[model samples]
Target chain A: MMHLLKIEWLKIKNYKAFLFISLFFLIGIFATNYIVYSVFHNIVNKSDAALLLSNFNPYDFEHVWQTVSYTSGYLLMLPSLLLIILVTNEYTFRTNRQNIIDGSSREEYANVKMMMALIVAATSTLFVVLTALAFAYSSEKDFSITGFSHVGYFFLKALSYNIIAIFISTLIKRTGFAIGIFFIYMGAENIIAQFLDVLSMKLKSSKNIDFGSLGDYLPMNSSDGLLSFPPTPLKSFTTSSLPTEYTWIVLGFAIFYLVLFSWLSRRLIIKKDL
Target chain B: MNVLSINNISKNYGKVTALQNVSFSVPRGSVFGILGPNGSGKTTLLGIIMDVLKATGGTYKLFDENPDNQLRKRIGTLLETPNFYHYLSAVQNLKITAGIKQRGENDIERVLEIVSLTNRKNSTFSTYSLGMKQRLAIAAALLGDPEVLVLDEPTNGLDPVGIAEIRELIKLLASQGKTIIMASHMLDEVEKVCSHVAILKYGELITFGNVDEIFINDDIVEVASSNIDQLKDALNLMPGNLKVEIKGNIVQITFPVGSANLENVNQFCFEKGIVLSQLQIRKKSLESKFMELTN
Candidate 1:
């Protein structure tokens, strides 16, 4: 297992793009801080929503944990883009073809790269958690921490998204196409669903607000959007998304994606031309 | 013992038949070359043996074990260009393969040295030239020191010197009692290295046999006589029973290579009143032999 890890690390070590993306991920943590801080501080705040958010604490140690949980959806991009390159570039570089020819089974190759993506996911999740903790402490010198129970919830949700990223990257196997699909699933594809919802609303027709269900096919919307419920700032004082059985559905789906993709990637890899 | 046995192995991809009832074997420690034109299923056959592909209708055994047996460790193959993460060094790539094989020995440095990539051990694969990558691929195959090696177009894209270097490496491995199965269209290269050759045409095995036997029996001898008509008649009565073709005054005959001849032929012709003007022996080049088998 350790040997496989070493091999994956060696493989990824030379990609200059991975380094650039990792650094960007680190910077994104700070970027989130700035966005949330500017919203809460009223310094050149232009929107009423921003003013309303002025009293909320994104950096407070108490709220930091909430913000981290809230922003996992945002932090997921780090692993998603990295994974796009990790899995898809193998096909483009023709290295996956060569690796298979050299004697490592395709499933072995897929699993090893998946394992590497898992590490990237684990660490990227860590960055979000650690930075959130740092911001929390910086904001409150005597920030008394509570709600340790939600940490498990945080870990599961974070794990599910990273695995989803790996699965998508593996299935698509093309960096450009995977990343584009990723962006669409994360943000744009749902616009069509939202537009559909709007047409019904203007007609004042009886339609369920639970229409977010359509996003499931889009991957990110059904997934990360599930985590978006139970507004973070409002519930910042007490973690309610935790112990909510409904979150289990989202968590379950994410886990399912990971397992399903793992099995599929393994099956298809052995038969590949390389 | 036959190290490999393929029993009517066939594979089809939906509408296209990639391989059809292809059958052949590699005897232990022999260098077997698979010769074919492009799209002739050379790689496909090798892939089936390695289990990189699932054959549609045939079965193959290696080392007396099934294709999926753990004995796969005893075989190393270079099916195409070497595949590994491009960011990794050659040693690192092999180590990853080592990890997958559950082989714990750290023979990476040694294999690198064998391929002469030790000097560039730290460099990323992207920096290595095409020949270096190929050598690295061969090094990866040799890492486990398996009993057999399968290489598909191993010398493709290499400089002539690089090709010769790899050829020598393969020859050396064969010398060490390893069964090497190489597939290529480069007839001369295969001819020089392979002890046994299998000619594949249109996804079928056109011919398979020991090189010395198949080609050795087809040597050429060019003879000319003053009385060509009488020479033809005399050659027909010869004891060696060589196949003779007359073109004007010159008659070319092919018999078993290195057969004792001409003196006996002269006596027979002299008794038959046929006078010989010229008689000389010649060897058949491998290319000619390949053409005979393939075309």
Candidate 2:
């Protein structure tokens, strides 16, 4: 597996897009957290809302992990886009066939790509951890690991997005088309999840029944649902009427989808002609 | 020992069959040619053997063992076209190929020099001309100097000089006791380089064996006269003529290989009181023989 990964590294080590996207993603993590960090530091601190908030600093050590993970989660799509381009580039260049012709088994080829996805997710998660630590230390608060689980959720979300990117790349086998479909699917899923969330709210209010959030049961949303804005006076005001958060069930669904997509991507490469 | 043994291999694309029950074995140390026209499933068959495409039915073995990645690493192959990372230089691309083959990482420079691309090895693959890209693919396939080579249209995009160079290179490699399986539509190319040949037409294997046996070099004599009928009759009665037939404005006589004598043909027509307008001996071209087999 390590030997296979070395070969994979050789393929992308000189790729301009790989380096460019990686640079943008690293900066995007810090820039996104900085933007959110400033909003609370500048406006919320001086505005009339500060009295109701009672001096809440989201970037403080207590909440920095959740804040950074949730804020950085939106930029997860960048790495996923990178993964899509890398995988689909093999098909675009027809090197996938060449790789196998050079003596790579279909299993080895597919396994290496999956390993790439895992490595990308791990590295992105590591960047998120670093960004959280940077913001937490700068807040001048005592160090704490209280809300670190949000970073773990961020890793799952990263892996979920990346595996889906690889799956779509294998199925679509074109760079622009796979990237387009990925964003389109994300948009379509969000709209449908919104409708389902509204329906779940209605069910809870009128029928006195609880199904948790049906929107969180979806593939992307299950992982997305794992991370949320940390509990605050402002956020609590809007949570009274929302459906209960079934963390365990949503976490289970997220894991199930990961395994399902991994298996599916592997099967497609193994059983089909290159 | 046989290098490759294919058993009843077949491939189908929906209702269209690309290969039908094709079976052949390539002996070691022989230059084997898979001769066929375009769209004749040559690339598809190689693809199946290299495990890039799934066989719809049947199986194949390499080096007298079940095919696997390890077995494939022993045979270098360039199938169909030049496939490489466009953004990478020729040297970089070869590195990836060598890395996959696991035995050619240190031999990149030597292979590039063999293909005469050593000077431009630093240029990106996308910047190469069609001929150069083809050369780079050949260079990659030559990495590690594998004992067997499967080249599909190996000279497809080369200039005349480049083509000649590759042909000479192939002969040189074969002289070194390497087994080469070449897929080409160029009959003359096969005739010049191959010791064994397999002819395929529309996905069916027509004939395969020693090149000498499959392509019997029968001699032909063409004679035309003022009276075509008299020319045909005289050739029929003449001795040593294997077969005689009338073509447009000419009478063609077939004879055993190297037995067609133009002087005898001309003399026979004159003795029959017919003045011959044209009498010429024609060597049986491999193209016509290939057409005869495929058609």
Candidate 3:
């Protein structure tokens, strides 16, 4: 597996898009968290609305993990988009076939791409951790690992996104079509999830029923629902009426979808003609 | 030992059968050719052997063992077209191939030189012309000095000179006792380099064996005389002739392959009191034989 990864590195080491996308993703993580940190420091702290929160700092050690994780989660698409391009580029160049011709088994070829997805997810999680630590340190609130599980959730979300990228790339070998379908699927799932979330809220209020957030049951949303903005005083005021957050169910669904996509991606490569 | 043994391999794309029950074995050190017309499943068969395309049914063995990736690592192949990362230079691309094969890391330069792409080694694959791309693919196949080579249309896009060079290269490789399985629609190319051939038409194996046996040309003796009917009658009386016919201004006698004797024909003509204006033997062309088989 290490040898396979070394070969994968050799393939992308000189690729310009790989360099550009990876650099962009790393910078985007830091820059995005910095922007959120500034908004809290400059505008929110100095404004008259500060009284509503009573001087609460979301960047404090306890909250920074969740805050940074949620803020950086929006930029998870960058890495996912990078993964889509990388996997689809193999098809575009037809190197996937060439690799097998050279010596790689169909299993190795598929496994390497999934390994890549895991590695990308890990690296992205590492960057999110660094960003969270930086913002947490600047708050001068004494280091704490509280809410650190959000970073773990962020890793799951990243893995979920990256694996889906690979799955879509395998299903749709064309680069343009795969990327287009990925975005379209994400958009469609989000819209449906929003409608389901609204329905779940109505069911909880009118019929005394609670199935957590029905929206979070979706493949993409299961992982997305795990991370949320750090609770502020204003948000806490409106949270009492909302349905309970079924963390275990959402996590379970997220893991299930991850395994499902990984298996499907491998099956596509193994069963189909290149 | 047989370098490759394929048994009843079948592939179907939905309702369309691409290859059906194709079976052949490539002997070690033999330059084998898979001959077929367009859309005749030459590439499809090679793809299945290289494991890039799965056969819908049946199985194959490499090196007389059940086929696997390790066995495949011992063979070098160029199938369909040159596939490489357009963004990387030739050296960079070959490095990736070497890494995968796990034995050619240091042989890149020598292989590139073999294909005469040394100067363009630093150029990206996208910058290469059609001929250069084909050459690069050949170079990749030559890496690791694999004993068995599977080439599908190895000279598909070469110029006349490039074609000649590749033919020499293949002959050179064959002289080194490397088994090469080449797929080509060009009958002359196969006739020139292949020691064994399997001719396919409409997803069926028409014939396969030693190049000499499968493409055996019948001996044709053409004789023209002032009296064409007399010449035809005289040749028809010949016991060893397969057929004797008057064609235009001459009489053509067909004999079994390698059985035509010009001296006997001349003596018999003189004894029959017929003066021959022209006497020559024509070896049947492989093109016509291929046409006869495929059409």
Which candidate's lDDT is highest?
Answer: 2
Error of 1 at A19 (Å): 2.3
Candidate 1 chain B: 10-residue stretch with minimal lDDT = B96-105
Q: All candidates' TM-scores?
A: 0.84, 0.98, 0.97
Compared with the real two-chain complex, what DockQ does model 3 have?
0.87
Give the TM-score, chain B only, in order for the candidates: 0.87, 0.96, 0.95
In angstroms, give how far residue B293 of model 3 lies from its true place: 2.3
Residue A22 of candidate 3: its Cα lDDT? 90
TM-score head-to-head 1 vs 3, winner: 3
Q: Could you tell me which 10 consecutive residues in candidate 1 chain A have the lowest summed lDDT?
A: A208-217
For residue A125, what is the lDDT in candidate 1?
A: 60
- Score candidate 1 by TM-score against the native: 0.84
- If the candidates were sorted by their lDDT against the true structure, best first, what order would they fall in? 2, 3, 1
For candidate 2, lDDT tens digit of each residue in B136-230?
A: 99998899999999999999899999999999999999999999999999998999999999888899999999999999999998889888887
Model 3 chain B: worst 10 consecutive residues (lDDT sum): B233-242
RMSD of 3: 1.5
lDDT of 1 by residue, A12-46 (tens): 77678889988887888778766776665555345
Q: Which stretches of candidate 2 lie over 4 Å from their true place?
A: B266-277
- C-alpha RMSD over true interface residues, each candidate: 3.5, 0.6, 0.7
- Docking category for candidate 3? high
